[model samples]
Target: MNKNKSEHTKDDNYLKHVSQIDQVNFLNFRRYLIDWYETVKRDLPWRKNQDPYKVWVSEIMLQQTQVDTVIPYFDRFIKQFPTPAALANAEEDQVLKAWEGLGYYSRARNLHAAVKEVAASYGGQVPVDKEELKSLKGIGPYTLGAIMSIAYNQPEPAVDGNVMRVLSRVFIIEEDIKKVKTRHIFEALVRRLIDQKRPSDFNQGLMELGALICKPTKPLCEECPLQSICLAHQQKIETTLPVKSKAKKQKKLNYYVAVIESPEGKILIEKRPSEGLLANLYQFPMIEQTKTDCSLLSEYLSAEYDTNLNQEQMLEPVKHVFSHLIWSIDAVKFMAQASFIPKEHQRWVDKKELGDLAFPVPHQKVLRQI
Candidate 1:
């Protein structure tokens, strides 16, 4: 593409970290990273497979989720679904059940949708090209890059938070990583340095480097291969490399989460609206945070339904943390003599079956305590 001066300048903006990185330096970093990865990379199950579907699933699941947490789920999910056709054939409820307690239910929902599309459109094979993969819903640039390189051996770059953190620190980038410009810049840097032949190794190497060596907290500088040329280490500010805007404050709200039980041992649960947070998951009947007593809960239940809340014994309050909110929940367990009624949003599930349906993570924590 031919470019005018202005266009060239705009494109040049993508190399803000070049002052600290060049062919020699990045190659050095890459060598060290690949070496460290060959030796120290954790034996993740997904790493053992080249199936694009499994790779995509693992990548999506690992988003903002811990490796320890994802390991078991990955194992079970592969066992349950095995292939794109199987996942696509399953019902939404079954898929959600498989993805229970993973917290971000949308990933599973989107995976289901994408699978159906792939089955119908691509003969159930996940596309290998970055552009084709990106065309699928919920597959963004980072995910597409991951899918391409990790599963297809394409030299595409996946500039996730971990990659961004690792690169920004390696090259002493000062731009706020939260910005779109930063993503473009860092992605370009990754593309420049990525080993064309062994891209899967390159992308995973970046992630592993960030996770273990270039951590946000006290980074292990001595053990790092880039130590000699690291500007952050020399500045004694390795802890503060990769500067970015502060995190948005999490919204705080009070909730009265009901663990209401009937005399028949049926627990009152509800299905959250299938649009927002954990939309397709099961949950306890809850009220927005407000000042409430036993009378308040009793009165509220009586006003809303056919089966009334009978007795009141509230459980200890639990605080549930989300990416953008903190729910201070009061688990109110009520013993009511109510039969099944199709209310606006409540379902009385049996105690036995409740274990199968995946409730949101924090709700499970409350269930464990109460």
Candidate 2:
């Protein structure tokens, strides 16, 4: 027997239970979910209109970010770049400034690229065709599904973590949701169960239900609309149904961040390379080391910039954790001994100009030491 086939067969057995729910119960499930959504859905800005641009922006910002944090950012971003044309016309630095605090810079970068394409090729309108939408950078399966169903009223499934949790509980699925195959399984189930007439509401309802009721911990089962039909709830295993494998441990790296101020009251900062971690963002001059060593920072400054650290003082360390890496930063403060010629990627900016330039969260913490 094929190992992959055996695993698929195991998953199919769980799906069979879902298919056995019959048309009438599926209708009831949809009715219960959509009715509850319409009644209690939170007043979010993106929900106000089915404008594909707004939906796309909100979806990208919301990924790996909380709604409460994204709301203000979304509001500010929309106000700044009201249309695809507006965003496409703006400078990358300006776009990054608007997205300053949002952790995932690549999302903003890719969205900017995609919006530029939208303005140039699609006449500032997000493409409606699935194939056309998929061609755009950062328009992954979940995002494509969201734009299609929520914006264009297509019957595509937006099966995110929330939807998976809700579905796994309702159908009592035991598959490890971390696997790619499990997502496909959930997508198939959604295609079958999704309300054709109100695909938008159906998709949003599942997401909302998972967020508010089918929570990862301490789910409010009594208040859930799907409680009547939830197999996991009936079996008293709602919390345990959505099985997910543990993520790999984040690798930790040490760095010495140098905060050097010139005699002219200009702060020295450098732009990260165009690609890789924290791409194209401004940060204090920093050097990665295997271990914490302040002397290495001095040597780096002398060699790289031909300047020595004067009035050197250690500042409070900053610890920033990314999805895959943890940065254990040792922040050092000093004044420039002499003005040296700045490199192409290095700049000396006054306080006001420094404030305007976008710095990633880690560098922002270092800046606070000044």
Candidate 3:
């Protein structure tokens, strides 16, 4: 099938518009964006210095997390692990504990591994070379761009969601931002537009503009500095410009969470497998089942641990949503028979010791019920 005449014309016009962002316009963009950023950019903790270690840690924590939520965590984490060597020398459990309540436990795990590499190989210095930085675990293109431009003041583009939305509107790009190819397109555009003298400010300005003014919903277009140049605003389509495809529906699973306690008042907890979802985290022993039937739970306890559920009582259900899945957990409390023996990867944790272990948020919800 061929595009109709109007569609062809629209495509031609978009290309022309993109091409029209010449050097003069690029200079103007930098002036407006950076000037605005210098005046109004939020005074984030990480912005205090160009330390690559702090930048790397903050960027990792900021992934899939909001800025406001990350502030305290960043402060506490930096206070605890002041240097790459500090984080590298710390135990994985300590890192996870500091990262507790921050979802995506894998980020903490990967950061720990990467920082250890930095300590061992780079003598506690974050690699300044692009290839060397990319060699570290969990450092992808965006993170690499951020470190190079922000920490090293190199001319690189840190194209994140905010930058994509801002640029897509400024040039009227219609590519689906969710696509990997679309990201490449945006990165190329940034490479062309970035200011060599002020790459840090330029990249951060785009992020600030999108976050503060070019928001996903109810964009403050009138307040935007780029209002005069934004093709989406000129066309009265600012809200509709950055085309994004809907994500796939999250798969849902149900489980029966056992909040069993011994007569000595120790809670039963088990370590999850060392890989996969919520890896290496601790949780109350749970069994996957369709229904929340105590009899089924009782049978499971009897079969697996040779334990009987005494004084069984149902607690409130807990629902946790993950990026790709949902957990609908039905929690129940019971006293295990005194003769029960702990299985491998399982333990009876005293209430005070629970704080020392890292449990994922869903299990944390179950803990609150007890």
Candidate 4:
């Protein structure tokens, strides 16, 4: 009985907090945001249409990537995979090739898999219903809400980091935004504040406000449409309201890269394992070290390639940071003996052929230098 009472009281408190937002105030909030969005939204390619396939591709590209970076890639990808059927029919390498340099290769793989299902099952049209949309692989709550609201104009709330930041500042929510529980609170608030008539505009407006005005630091509170009613701004604590815990330190690793060029001037590249980091991407052969060192490269080349490799030059170290790991790569140029043979997953390619193969950004950088 005591436990039930405690749970009920907690739910009551949550409801009470949300109830503080009156109907009139909520309407005014929505009105101001929609009005502001109409005047000042970014002229994005995806925003020009209500096509769900375009929206889905743009959203996936925008995950952990910036808008400016996504625009060209989105354009090129759509041109290549104009429909679900196009992506479904295309080879995996072709899909990854289109998505090269975007990072998070898994998103590309999942999108490919999901689009194949969409082509076969949904007849190349993105599903309209929320539950059906959720059933697709890689389509989570946020993506589902975004597609439903933006493309379908449903009264679904697209609560991403931008939306969370905007709401946390507007409501003066002091809860840690990093916690999974906190997202539910923000989602509920969005449900209350979402404009029924223009769900797409309203959701986009909130995200736009966060991206342009209610920023992480030195927020342009004066420019925000919600400035008048924003709790954080009203309390003069806008910069400090949406508190998020810092992420864990990335594990540092050292990789000694071997750029082996055969006597005929073709470079040796290998395909990464089908699983794990940089899966199925092409790169020069490499040996990881406990710390930054180049002595192991000679021995590794002899044992792995069964050839004597003369290290021509040791270039400057290159750093590539992922979400959870930092790669400190030392690229070494080596000349493979003429008798060297290409092993499994390894092939010799000229510069033109290298361009055709999809190499991760770090490898691309080193290739340019070599």
Winning model by lDDT: 2
lDDT of 3: 0.87
Clashes of each: 1, 0, 0, 0
Q: How close to the true structure is residue 48 of candidate 1, measured as C-alpha lDDT? A: 84
lDDT tens digits, residue span 63-145, model 3: 99999999999999999999999999999889989999999999999999999999999999999998899999999999999
RMSD of each candidate? Answer: 2.6, 4.0, 5.7, 3.7
lDDT of 4: 0.85
lDDT tens readout by residue for model 4, 142-200: 89899999999998878889998988877777888898777777776777678998999
Q: TM-scores for all candidates?
A: 0.92, 0.93, 0.93, 0.93
lDDT of 2 at 118: 96
TM-score of 3: 0.93
Candidate 3, residue 181: the lDDT equals: 74
Report every candidate's CA lDDT.
Answer: 0.82, 0.89, 0.87, 0.85
Model 1: ten consecutive residues of lowest lDDT: 2-11
| Residue 28 of model 1, lDDT score | 75
Positional deviation of 277 in candidate 3, in angstroms? 0.8
Model 2: runs farther than 4 Å from truth? 1-24
Pairs with backbone N, CA or C atoms under 3 Å apart (clashes), candidate 1: 254-289
